[model samples]
Target: MVTAFDEALTCLKDEKIRITPQRIAILEFLTEVQTHPTAEEVYQAIEKRFPGISVATVYNNLKRFTELGFLKEMNYASASSRYDFSLKPHYHVICESCGKVADFYYPKLDDVEVAAAQLTNYTVKSHRLEIYGICPNCQQVEGE
Candidate 1:
């Protein structure tokens, strides 16, 4: 698996854009923390390691990576946006009680994508499916 850390290093010499230490730090943090953290979380974690790195730099680098198809931005009823490295089409299940997020994979979604493309005639580039509700742990806790 090509991690964002490795990707950052590999793209250093190959990417059309210039790479900075700040960018590398941001990518590495995102790659290491797979919880789909927000920009603030990433900034806070990386700032201690890369002193003087501003939150704006992290935000910009995230935007650049997403534009380059190296990362993805997701919003889940949170105050800030979340990011993910998964490039493939998959779904997400969010726990309403605790705000926990988990990935859901379904290979058969390709058929649905094709159907959406035909119906909209817009050439579906991508799609997102999020199922939101209380999770098992939360349900169990509430039951008790």
Candidate 2:
């Protein structure tokens, strides 16, 4: 499997985004965390290892990566936004109790995309899907 860091570098090159150490660190953190981290969370983690990097840099890089189609920005019912490095057609299962997230892959989405393309006059560029529910842990805790 291609490592997330390598994927990020390739994405940067493809989008003609400058590849700097700070950007790489931000990308690496996004890849490793896989928790759909917030900008503040990313900044705090990167700050510990990288003193000179700023919170603004983290936010900017996240936006650039999203434009490059390498990362997806997710919004919950809560106030804050989070970032995910996985760009493929997949859905998210979010835990309501603890706020954990899991990625779900659905092959049927390709068919759905085709149907949507035929139904709409406008081009269907992309789609986002997320399901919110209580996780197993939360269920177990509630059972107690």
Candidate 3:
């Protein structure tokens, strides 16, 4: 089966981007993770596998990937931007306490976009919805 890593490599090849060991490791790491990670977090995770790898490399590749639409860059006012690998339409629920992000899908929101376009007579390209509250883990810790 063609995995997400394979597909990403194919896309990179089509774009004429050089495929290096570091790049491959980065792509594989991102594909396997559901947790939205910051550039620093990504660096910390992969640095063990690739000794001497610089954080700048991770940041640059992440920026390139985001520009190529391989992933989405989610920025929060309270913290550093996080990278999300999933491209499907969905909203996020953020943990205000720990800054964790989780995805949720609601098909009805698509209709809201259509209604908005109709009401304003303007083209709606996209939208973002973020619901913030303490996550379960944080709540448990608080209770304890």
TM-score of each: 0.79, 0.78, 0.95
Which pairs, if any, clash in model 2?
Answer: none
| Clash count of each predicted structure | 0, 0, 0
The RMSD (Cα, Å) of candidate 1 is: 2.6
Candidate 3 clashing pairs, residues 3+ apart or interchain: none
Which 10 successive residues of model 2 have the least lDDT summed? Answer: 121-130
Instruction: Report how far residue 127 has shifted in candidate 3, in Å.
Output: 1.2
What are the candidates' C-alpha RMSDs?
2.6, 2.6, 1.1
Best prediction by TM-score:
3
What tens digits encode model 3's per-residue C-alpha lDDT throughout 44-112? 989999999999999999999888888789998666999998888899999999999999999888898
lDDT of 3 at 39: 94
lDDT of each: 0.80, 0.83, 0.91
Off by over 4 Å in 3: none
Ordering by TM-score: 3, 1, 2
lDDT of 1 at 120: 84
Query: What residue runs in model 1 are displaced by over 4 Å at the alpha carbon?
Result: 1-4, 118-122, 136-144
Q: Residue 122, candidate 3: how far off, in angstroms?
A: 1.6
Flag regions of model 2 displaced more than 4 Å.
1-4, 13-18, 117-123
